[model samples]
Target: MRVLAAMSGGVDSAVAAARMVDAGHDVTGVHLALSSNPKSFRTGARGCCTLEDSRDARRAADVLNIPFYVWDLAERFRADVVDDFVAEYAAGRTPNPCLRCNEKIKFAAVLDRALALGFDAVCTGHYARVVDGPDGRELHRAVDPEKDQSYVLGVLTAAQLAHAMFPLGDTEKTDVRVEAERRGLAVARKPDSHDICFIADGDTAGFLRGQLGEAPGEVVDTSGEVVGSHDGTYGFTIGQRKGLRIGTPAPDGRPRYVLDISPVDRTVTVGAREELAVDELVGVSPRWCGPAPDGVVECAAQFRAHGEAVPARADVSDEILTVRFSVPQEGVAPGQAIVLYDGDRVIGSATIDRTSARAASPA
Candidate 1:
């Protein structure tokens, strides 16, 4: 089958494309140009979209003897991912740009274009699996737990999963590097990209500030006592425990965490660590990989990347999904993804809208 591999000039993707070639599938490598004006990329213990990365991807494609091209999605990326990220922050909510990129750019836009051009599927180096289940194609976490990326991909819809391919799902990262080395690929030793790719310095706060400008606000405690002042409420996120200039010390001298960010009042509220625990979350814009389940369904819900999945029940109502955790979860933040799973298979996901206060008594 003809497949278009989304190469990001990284070792994982290079090896993924090579593996597809080895499997006797017709493969084409395409690097997504997320930024129009190239600058010095920051790796920050992770990989970056640098000129070197594009060269590395081309080299790998050449070694595999496959056609390679760079598709410029800079404008779309800025609008769909970067701008959305800034806007979410300005609204006092933390947004995941990677998830947005996967949902809007990779799956929606790129997949549509590929299908129109007669490609059977669009492949990527994402560390997630897609398997035929009882109902239909189901997504699962990668074999390698540390590198599993299902969280970022939970936003994919059923139609998107139909033509998506993840060649590195069952393979380990070490083995991928080995394959790249054996294939004489130059990116075998290339490091993985960490944090947001467009944010060169990993300064999310600074990036948000630059986009939204300074909106000075007051930092208050749970009791509405103004403890300090901040440049903007966008600079803070739920469960953030550091960089808060609130001069007051906790009773035990432990740091306080941001419990809530009120964009309407331009205020950030801090509380003790205990206040971060949440037992229920309400999500908006739910997307299912397959058919939406009926009534309250038991599933594993993941709130953050690399975080553990907690047992939960989801009540889907059109565009809104409400998830109640079996156990109170700490750091449940609004605007983060709440991905649902049935064992290893991904059921669906939603963007967290708000987290309800813990129940007075366990039901």
Candidate 2:
């Protein structure tokens, strides 16, 4: 089998590619140049897709003695992931760029291209397992729970999973680094990238301000009384407490959290922390890993990438997925993906459209 290994200039990816080579598969390493201006993006051990990362990937491939190439997907990444992130923020929703990158770039674009070039599968360093269940190929959590990335990979379809390879899923991060060191890979000591890759300084508010210029707005209470003023509503998300800079103190003398953000009216509503609790969620654009479930099914719903999975009852009808939590959840913002799981297997995922504060009933 011919395999296309995506070397990201990181310890995990380098080890994954090495394992592919050891497996005796005809392996080719490809580094994706995601940034149009590599110098502008984050550099060094804290960033990815920069010029330094590309060189590191090439060196790793050379060490493994495999054919290497670089593919520039900057335009596609900008249009699909970066632009979508900005737009989602402008529309008062919190979006995860990593999920978009996996859905639109890695699995969709890279996999399509690899298959067209006669490659059997696209392998990556992501910490998620692909198991051949009785039904078919199923995505599962990694052996190391701390590094499981199956939440972001939930956007992949059944077909995508069929041709996907995660070579490092069964190994721990520490062990992967050790294997890389033994294989003479220099990225064995590279620091893992954190925060957003595009935002070098980690100042997301400033980055959004640059993208969507300042639109002065009023921060009002639930009763419509103005309490503060903000440069832009895009700087806030649901359940944000710090940096509110509210002039008027609450009568109860408690900190206020952002309850709602109306981008059209340029109004931000602030209230008590309890107001952020949501018991129900309506999600749009559901992506199933395999066949859609019939009737109501018991599952665990994960709101964030590393968030805890809560007991939930989910059902889909008319292409709209609705989930009812056994207990109220907090800080569930729109435009975020709610990944549903059955034990360790990923069942499906959906983009959160809206949430309700109604009382939760037993599932």
Candidate 3:
């Protein structure tokens, strides 16, 4: 098999490429240059994409004795991931840029290019397993539950899964590091990159402020009573409680949580914590790992990458996936993905467009 390994200059990718070579498959290492400007460096995890990363990738390929190249997809990444992120925040929705990057750039751009160049698959360090099910290819949780990345990978279509390879699926992060060390890869101890790679400063609010600018708005209690004011609504999420400038407590002197945001009115609503409990969600733009299932299916739904999978049933109508949880779920923000699974196999996923919480009973 001919493979193009995506070396992210991390221990995981380094080991993955080595394993592919050990398995006797023809392998080539490719580093994605997602950053437009590689001269200046960002500190912390975001620094993983600096020119240092490219050099590290080249070293890993040299050690593995495989051909190496760097593919520059910076423009596509900016338009697809970063712009979508800012737009989602501006529209009062929380978006996952990693998921978007995989859906658009990794599987779409990189994989397509690999296939065009006569490669059978594009390998990456993502901790998710692709298995052949009764129907076709299926995405499953990695053996290392602590590092499972199936939630973000759920956006992949059946075709994408057909050409994707995750060599680290069966191993833990510690094992990968050890393997890299044994292979004499210097990046064995490199720190993992932080989420939101584009935001070098790690200031999400500050980044949004720069893009959307400050539009002062009023923060209101549940009953439409003005409580405080905020510079912008992009800084706050649906279930956020802290950083709310509102000094006054609720009538019961309990904690208040952000229940809703009206981007039209530029108003944020705060209420008791129970108000954040949601029983059902309406998801849009559902993507199935295989053929879309007909009628309803009972499956485990994951809202966050590391979040617990909850018991839920989904009914698909058109492209919308309506999910009802066995118990009320809290802190489900719009634009976040709700990935459905049957045991370990990824069934499908959809972006949350709306939610309905059951009214909390009296205390």
Candidate 4:
């Protein structure tokens, strides 16, 4: 089979491309240029879209004796991922840029281009697995729970999964590093990037300020009492506890969390931490990779990456999904992805539209 490996100048992707060569599949390496300026965010421990990273990927491909090329998708990335992120935040929602990159660039644009060029599949270093199921190709969690990325990739369409390969799904990160070391790969000891790839200095508020300009607003409590002032309501997110300039202390001396952000009114509402607990979430633009399930189903719902999935009952109507958790979850934010899972398999995912506190049952 012909495979096009998306190399990100990381140890995992280097090892993935190497393993593909070892498996006797005809492989080609491609590095995506997502950032307009590579040096903009290359300070420390950053990943991908850097000149050094592209060099690392090219070097790895050279060592593996495979064809390599760099594809520039900066314009598309800016339009689809970065702009969308800024827009969501401006609307008082927190967007996950990684999930957007996977859905728009990796799976949609890159995969489509590869398939059009006669490649049978596009491979990546994502720690997720595709398995044969009763209905069709099923997406599952990686063997390495610590590095499972199925939550982000849950938005992929069925057709995308059919032509995608995750070579590092079954292997541990430690082993991947070991293999890269054995191959003398340059990224063997490279530290993993932890911050947003496009945002330098890791200042989300500053980044948003630069993008949306400054809109001074008032910070208030749940009772509409002004507690402090902020440059913009977009700088704050639901459930954020710190950085709030509220001078007064709560009665119990506990910290307050942001319970609501009204972009229309340009006001942020703060409340006690207890108000953060939510039992129901409504998701819009839901996408099912496979067939949509019928009737009510009990499953796990994840509101954010690296969060534990909570048991919930999901109701699907058209493209809208509503999840009622068995237990209330804290910090459910809008614009984040809500991935539904049945055990290890990803059933589907959607963008969170709103969240509400559970209503009381009749006595």
Candidate 5:
């Protein structure tokens, strides 16, 4: 079968491409140029989609003796992932750009193109397994629990899973690096990139402020009384406790956490740490990997990419999914994903629209 490996200029991707070649699959390597600036090079630990990454990917391809091409998807990336991220924040929600990239850019855009060109599959280095389940193709957690990336891929549909290949799903990250070194790949020791890539300086707040500009607003306590002022609400997320700029301590002497942000009125509400607990979360635009749900089901829910999975009962209706956790959790931000898992298999996921500690479940 012919395969197109999406090389990201990292050790993981390099090893993934090598494994595909070892298996004797007709393979070609393609690096996605996601940055708008043509000459920008990957610098520091947060570099992404820069020219350096593309060059590294090409080097790996050369070592593998495979044809390589760099595809400029910057415009598509900006519209689908980067712009969507900024828009989500502007609407008072915390969004995961990686998830968006996987759903829209990698699986949707790249996969579509690969199929159009008659490639059998789009291979990637994501640390998640694709299994031929009894029902159908299913997504599962990687063997390396610490490196499992299935949470971000919850948005992928059954069709996308059919054409997706993750060669590193069963291997640990350490082993991948070792294999890369053995194969003479220089990316074996490359430092892992950190934080959001587009925010070049790592100042998410400042970056958003530059894009959205300063829309100073009132910072209020739980009682709705103004406690301080903030330059913008886009810089804040649910359960954020630092950089709040609330000078005076609370009467109870407890630190305050951001409980909610109202972009409509440009207000940020902060409260006691306990107020961050959310017991019930409702997700919108549910996407099932295999089969769409018929009714409520018990599953483990992961709210963040690297966060712990909690026990929950989920119900799907129309496009909305309601997940009620057995215990409350902190940092349940709107616009984040609620990926549902049945054991190691990923059943489905949804985009969080609302969460509350006291809200009753409509399911």
Candidate 6:
């Protein structure tokens, strides 16, 4: 089998490509140039896909003695992932760029191109397992829970999973670095990338401001009293607590969290932390890993990438997914993904659209 290994200039990906070579699958390493201006994407531990990362990937591929090439996907990434990210935030929803990258760029674009070029499968260093279940190929959590990345990959469909490979899924991060060092790979000591890759300095608000510019707005309480002001509604997200320039403190002396953002009216609503809790979620653009569930299925829903999975009942109808949590969840912002799981197997994923909290009883 011919395999296209995506070497991301990181320890995990280098090791994954080496394992593919050792397994005797005619392997070819490809580094994705995601940013046209690589210098702007940051180097070192903070981010990835920069000029330095591409060079590192090439050197790693040379060490493995595999045919190497670089695929420039900057335009596609900007249109699908970067642009979508800013638009989602501008519309008052928190978008997960990692999930969007996996859905639109890696799995969709890369996999399509790999297959067209006659590659049997596309392999990566993602810490998620692809198991051949009785039904078909199913995506599962990695053995190393601390490094598991299945949440961001829950957007993959059945066909994509069929031709996807994660050679490092069962290995720990420490062990992967050791293996890379043993294989004479320079990136064995490379620091893992974190935060948004495109935002080099880790200042997300500042980056958004540069793109969307300043649209001064008022921060009001739930009762519609103005308490503070902000440069733009895009700078705030649901459940954000700090950095709100409120002139007066809350009457209860407790910190206020952002409860809502009306981008249309440029108004941000603030309230107590308890006001952020919601028991119900409605999501759209559902993508299943295997078969779609039948009617309402008992499952667990994960809102954030590393967030705890809460037991919930999920129902899909008319291409919409609705989940009811047994326990109310907080920090569930719209435009984020709601990934459903059956124990360790990924059931499906959907982009959160809205949420509802049951009315409180008169105390």
lDDT tens digits, residues 1-363, model 1? 899998888988887888788889999999888887656444442335777677778888888899999988899999999889988998888888889999999998899999998899999999999999887788999999989999999999888998998999999899989888888988888777888888777788887888888888888888888888999898988999889988777667878999999998899999888888889889998899899978789999998988999899999876789998888888888889999999988889999989876559242
lDDT of each: 0.87, 0.92, 0.90, 0.89, 0.90, 0.93
Model 3 bad stretches (over 4 Å):
39-47, 358-363
Which residue pairs in candidate 4 collide?
A: none
The superposed Cα distance between candidate 2 and the true structure at residue 137, in angstroms, equals: 0.3
Let me know the TM-score candidate 3 reaches against the reference structure.
0.97
Error of 4 at 254 (Å): 1.4
Model 6 gets an lDDT of: 0.93
lDDT of 4 by residue, 183-270 (tens): 9888899877667888856888998999999998888888888888898998898899999988877767889899999888899999
Q: Model 3 lDDT vs. the true structure?
A: 0.90
- Whichever of 5 and 6 has more lDDT, that candidate is 6
Error of 2 at 142 (Å): 0.9
Q: What is the overall TM-score of model 1 with all chains considered together?
A: 0.96
lDDT of 5 by residue, 199-299 (tens): 66688898899899999999999788888999999989998999999976899998999999999999999998777888898999899999987789999
Instruction: Report each candidate's C-alpha RMSD, comma-separated, in the order given.
Output: 1.7, 1.8, 1.5, 1.7, 2.1, 1.5
Model 6 lDDT per residue over 1-363, tens place: 999999888888899999999999999999998887777334433788788888889999999999999999999999999999999999999999999999999999999999999999999999999999988999999999999999999999999999999998899999998898899999989889899988877899999999999999999999999999999999999999999999989999999999999999999999999888999999999999999997999999999898888999999999999999988888889999999999999999999999998776111
RMSD of 5: 2.1
TM-score of 5: 0.97
Q: What is the TM-score of each candidate against the true structure?
A: 0.96, 0.97, 0.97, 0.97, 0.97, 0.98
User: Could you tell which candidate, 4 or 5, scores higher by lDDT?
Assistant: 5
Superposed on all Cα atoms, model 3 deviates from the true structure by an RMSD in Å of 1.5
